[model samples]
Target: MKKPLKFPDFKDEDKAADWLDKTDFSDHLEPSDLKKINLPNLKSTKRLISLRVEESLVEKAKQKAVKLHIPYQTLMRQVLHRGLEAI
Candidate 1:
């Protein structure tokens, strides 16, 4: 019988990262180590369209997005959606 795989505890994030970088985890993993997980499908219907806007507006959006910790494109989508709803 094969020995069960074990993971060593690391003192810090850097140590963990170093261990992961040097180790091939697949070599130690067994079928029993796997777990079944059911995650909701995140498929969305979004079309890619090219549109031109002022460079200043895009820069403003990017700055605001950084403050809000979201992507500029997502901020633009939310702004457009809100505008459409208001109309």
Candidate 2:
């Protein structure tokens, strides 16, 4: 079996940050640089509840996200939005 590669330890935050900044990301923008879209604000909304799901189900969703190269949270949000629209 092939062993996973290990990264070298860095002593300073600046050095680590600099290395990451130089890494190629295929022309992706930093989070702060992205254009913001105006969505309807839900600040006045209340009664939001959080639910826990089985670890296996969460892992399955994460695996699907990895396969599609998108964030798992984004996939979950889209699914929730579609379900609400159907109701």
Candidate 3:
């Protein structure tokens, strides 16, 4: 089996993203090395911002958050995280 390259230890997310921009995942990752990460206690350091979002969209997000049993802000963060991963 081909040895998987270890992902570099980054000081912060920006550095990790910079590395990702320069590296191809196929060269560094293997299916067997993939593992589920659950950060139930993780707290993100967030910056306060005023964002203009559609009222209907906000209501839909609140409904989804209620269904998922998470805070609406937490649900929004999850969605944003997934969107960032797609880039």
Candidate 4:
């Protein structure tokens, strides 16, 4: 039987990447160590764009966002989503 491999300590990200690139951990890892991940659909992801709105409106949204414990941008998205649903 092949001996189980031990993970090496790296000083920084570049070393870690170098080690990862060269080493195969399949022999050392158990089935339980693997996890299934679902990546988001790139087509449906949000795109950043420039939108101009009144400063007072942004301040109101910021105040509301603080009260709801969420980022103002998130609050804006929620509001926009609701408005779109109403249309």
Cα RMSD of all models vs. native, in order, equals 14.6, 17.0, 7.2, 14.2
Clashes of each: 0, 0, 0, 0
Please give the ranking of all candidate structures by TM-score, highest first, separated by commas. 1, 4, 3, 2
Report, for every candidate in turn, its global Cα lDDT versus the true structure: 0.75, 0.61, 0.75, 0.75
At residue 76, give the lDDT of candidate 4.
97
Say which candidate scores most in TM-score.
Answer: 1
TM-score of 4: 0.51
Off by over 4 Å in 4: 1-44
Give the TM-score (vs. native) of candidate 2.
0.41
For residues 1-87, write the lDDT of model 2, one tens digit per residue.
233323345555434545666665435555455455442322332245787989897888899999989999767765775699799
Cα deviation in Å at residue 40, candidate 4? 6.5
> Candidate 3, residue 83: CA error in Å?
0.3
Q: Worst ten-residue run, lDDT, model 3?
A: 37-46
- After best superposition, candidate 4 residue 39: deviation in angstroms? 5.7
TM-score for each model:
0.53, 0.41, 0.50, 0.51
- Give the distance in Å from residue 24's predicted Cα in candidate 2 to where it truly belongs: 31
Q: On TM-score, who's better, 1 or 4?
A: 1
Look at candidate 2 and give me any clashing residue pairs.
Answer: none
> Candidate 1 lDDT, tens digit per residue, 1-87?
245556676655445555667887666667667766432332344679999999999999999999999999989987996699799
lDDT of candidate 4? Answer: 0.75
Candidate 1 backbone collisions, by pair: none
